[model samples]
Target: MAHKAEDRTYDVIVVGGGPSGFVAAIAAAREGARTLLVERYGFLGGMPTSAALGPISPFYFDDEQVIQGIPHEFVQRMVADGGSTGHIRCTNPHGSGSYLCFYDREAYKWAALSMILEAGVTPLFHSFVSGVRVEGDRVTGVSVTNKSGTSFYSASVVVDATGDGDVATLAGAEYVVGREADGAVQPSTMMFDMAGVDTAAVKAYMDDNLDDFEWASEMVAVHPYSERLPRQHFVGQGFKRLVKEGMDAGELHLGRDSVLFLTTCHPGVLHFNSTRIQNVDGTSAESLTAGEIEGRRQVMSLSRYLIARFPGFENAQLIATGVQIGIRESRHILGEYTLTADDVMSGRKQEDVVARGYFPVDIHNVDGVEGYGEGGVWAGLDDSYDIPYRCLVPARLDGLVIAGRAISASHEAHGSFRTQGGVMAIGQASGTAAALAALGGVAPRRLDVAELQAALLRQKASLRRDPERAREERRRAVQAVSAALAEGRISAKYLADAGTFTGQAPRL
Candidate 1:
């Protein structure tokens, strides 16, 4: 059978409809661009929807709401829909300085699709970006494929949110994979869910055994045994002795001493973040296949052990697994700015900081201690660190912007900003920049920085500020916007539900 291939063009094309790509597509379309979003999966929410990577993280910094704007809107929608646990305090044995939103996977997929359609983004699901179209070093479009064969999509600006930097690498962008010395990337895990868990009993057990587990890092400060303890709901109980018993009895395969668990918005259902598959390269098809096999194998043994020993899981049943294995790190495209671990550790600020990553350097199981928490100890972010615009720009490319875990950051810094919340902000910033560049008919490299920042502000993106100074600035801005919102200074974009509004204002 012969298939006819067609070529289509858009002002902006966002590849990889994950946490980053979906937002990028939304922002571009909102900018009035003929935006097209291409995703490999049938549904959006790469990790959250596919992997059941619940609970969006770091919405609050120092326990205050930090990340805001479109992603926040998505979170609010999740909460209102009864699909999420809203915002829960950190209570993981790994430590409790961050917050998470345990959202229902299927609900997230629906909400994401709704947002994408509402933004006027033409979403092509069940298709993937297979190649990039370039003129010299500038990416002009992409080659995509599906069961129907192959096609081409031309765009004025291209946003690479493939997480693995597939489009950027296909466009001949220089990239670093895994760690610098030995080429060992962080292990990718799979998330699953267990239903019919006696969560109250489990919580009671953890409450009684708070002193048994190791925290993610010393940076995470939690006053143990106080009211602040339940915030560790996301943490896996550290039953070192019991885990060893399982291992000694040949019931456990992984070296990790604890099984991760998180509570969901739905009662009696718990999110399971176990099954760590290390040393498998996500970029390799063969490795990923083996990893999935091993992950599934582990899930069975782990689940059996839980039902046999752990409380609340005796009647538990395996309900879900991620659409794919949860990939933590893959390729870091050499961008205009490579954010370093020191930058994340020291809480560095930059003049052109467009987004903030409030999490720590959480390297999962690369150094072999265990995959439970951060691989190393680093000072916690005093407030939050800024992700500069240069991180999105490839060092030698034009019209191609990278987002999500693929941004130009050192191996260490990648660990911090790789989470969903951090990636969401990065995506919004990259999307906004792509739209501005396309609208102005200029290379993203040449778009006016101030003008772009102003555009982001109009979208209600929270630009990085001195944490101390932003308090007053945020106070006044919130007051002004609240008053304006009440006095009919409202647009459909800003008129959603009752929530603390962030960002300066939207441009009508």
Candidate 2:
């Protein structure tokens, strides 16, 4: 049963109101394109708001700030609401200077909404993108269903940011699902919020049990059942192994255990973005439904555990659950170039690099993989890499650009580049490229790289091509550290500390 089509048209249409769609709508409209953003939810902020993820992680690139433009502005506004810190060297047991901030999720949502409205972008909420309208090899419009019924909204260009590549898939774009070799997709998380907690007591527990409570490992074993799950472990040999190296180097803080990514938010209130729901497929409605059901069960159990285990949480209550299941990986539309694990490891910079992602390849397991157990697979490069423009341009699509978790990249690369900060960078690029394509009457895949760079520059993006300045800073840091070692003023501990401090070696 279909209703009458509205046939309302705009210059651009962005589907999904997550990080990518929010930025895409703003970017296109700011460039003078009449844009419409449709979201199934009433409010925006995607995962951060919907999931109640109070903290935003990995906001810096190396020792310097990387993500700028709209995303930075959004974060800065939130930081202003609280007391936001800036540009510190992140290196410790769990990488202290990674520049993650504990924020107000509601405030973030309001800020994102304000930015979109100010850009003069029309946002239609409670409307889901049901079908895409295409003519021949190009996408011309999309059909969205709401309380009114199924209505078509035409557009000159479309950017897919549904995280699962929903719009592009519906629009006839071909894509790949999961991994190729081992059939591994990144694990999904179900975050929750707790109120009536004591910040001091929880922080003390974290310090005392830093090694025994391993949330990632324990959750992988006991989830999909239990309303009273076991407590998360933080104090153990595994955590010790991670901290000993960094603490010894002097490059890291002595109490490096304080920041080992345990599921400990502020004391009185806590956000549980820990439970790893594995083997869930984002594309299938059935699979996603199963994940959601299992996720809620695990969350309830975990919440009960928090009440019983810690001192401050005796009165703690589960106040909120994620509005939507947090998906880590999904259907990726095959693009002009496939980003490989090698590109990320080597920190390769491409001439057509559109956005930069510095987060590590934080892969969770699928099926019966080892995970970060006693001797787990924990390998990552201590640098950021550039995502080329070709990765966002679908191989066969003319009017579509892919952003967020579904951008064309290997499963390994996707794990690293799928954070909120990284997604914003991709969204900015996609929106800018779409606007450029519409103006030039050219395919998004064929836009000139130099011209795009100029536009990005005018927008104050951080992709300056001064290879010499970057090289010189590394050289100076190395030279200074070498001198201290030669003078015997520093021990083997000192040399190791210097390497880690300069970001040459792993934090721990």
Candidate 3:
């Protein structure tokens, strides 16, 4: 095949069309950049669309909802299309607070694609960014492969949103893989949906069985799991509690015609992310392959369990599986600043901050103990800390900006930053900053801090300052709750949800 040279240059070329890349392309184009988005898959919305993920996880910033910029618009569109419930659940992550929203994956994908088209971004699907072309200290373009073989696309700025930092590492950016010393990384889960579930029957079943913790414990103990991450028996019951509260408050109606039914949706659809693959290095292709294989097997088991044990699900079937490997760990590109776990716990603000991660440090480990059985614990700083612009700037790499889960941060901090909601936040800021840097004819690191902050604000990003004050406020709240827990002033369950746990002992 003969490769032909094209005489076109884009103002911005974004690699990896996941949550981060999709938002990056929209942000850049909205800022008046001629953007081209390249995705490895056939369509957009990396994990959510391709992998069939449900909802936007870890989406709130304290009581104030933080995911309100470009991503919010995409979500709203999905809700309006009758594709999602748009239910925002506020969870206390080990006493730390977080928000999650349930969304229809296909609806969200279409919404993202619509945004890109509306913003005039040229999306090249089924294209993989294989290599980066560098000239002097600046990245001139990227090498990509498609059905047409290898080709080059030149751009003034490149945003790497491939959750694994594929483009960044290929561009010679230094990065860290997995955890140091402890050899722990968040466990990966393959989410699957079940259908033919009767919502009312499912709710009734949970109400009757959630208190049967002993029975669940015995069953899970015998379950063939390679890792022993504490499985919470009360998660189903907890949701039942929430439902009761909603019904009492008149916020949720559970009747047959009610669209807000708990388990039943469209007559037969249920989603599960129960396949847990631990110690799987997300960056290594071999490990990822193994995880995928195991994920499929786990989903098959879950399908059997649902059919045998649960009501409504007896007729339910596993209709779909995630499109890509649900990777929970990957490379962390070293930047000018390494965000520490302490920063996240204290909600430390920074003068040079470009974005804030309000989600807790949800550290998921293979040997991690179980207490509540939901997700991981949030031991990070109170409130949220700023993600310094430097974290996105790959160390010693010019004109290359790393976005999404690959940004420089401690392993603990990565949990807070790796959520889909958090990725969209960082992606918007990084994309706009990259476009501005390209226009200014300077490397992303060399761009003026004030200018970058101004650009971020213009794009409606909630980048904060004054870390010390935020830290003090959060510290006071945490201390007050810790004292209450110590004196048995509050229920342990409540403390766990509010993120107020203060012991080496597990909460369960």
Best by lDDT: 1
lDDT of 1 by residue, 22-83 (tens): 98888888888888899998999886777668667666564445678788888777656666
lDDT tens digits, residues 436-501, model 2?
887777888889988887786677666643456545544443443344345443333312134543
The clash number for model 1 is: 11
Per-prediction TM-score to the true structure, in the order listed: 0.86, 0.80, 0.79
Using lDDT as the yardstick, the better of models 1 and 2 is 1
Q: In candidate 1, what residue range of length 10 has the lowest lDDT sum?
A: 217-226
Query: What TM-score does prediction 1 earn?
Result: 0.86
Question: What is the model-wide C-alpha lDDT for candidate 1?
Answer: 0.75
Rank all candidate structures by their lDDT, best first, as comma-separated numbers. Answer: 1, 3, 2
What is the lDDT of every predicted structure here?
Answer: 0.75, 0.67, 0.67
Pick the winner on TM-score between candidates 2 and 3: 2
How much does each candidate deviate from the true structure in C-alpha RMSD?
Answer: 9.1, 9.7, 11.1
Number of clashing pairs per prediction, in order? 11, 20, 21
Q: What is the C-alpha lDDT profile of model 3 across 72-99, one tens digit per residue?
A: 7776776677665443322233332333
Error of 2 at 311 (Å): 3.3
Worst 10 residues of 2 by lDDT: 216-225
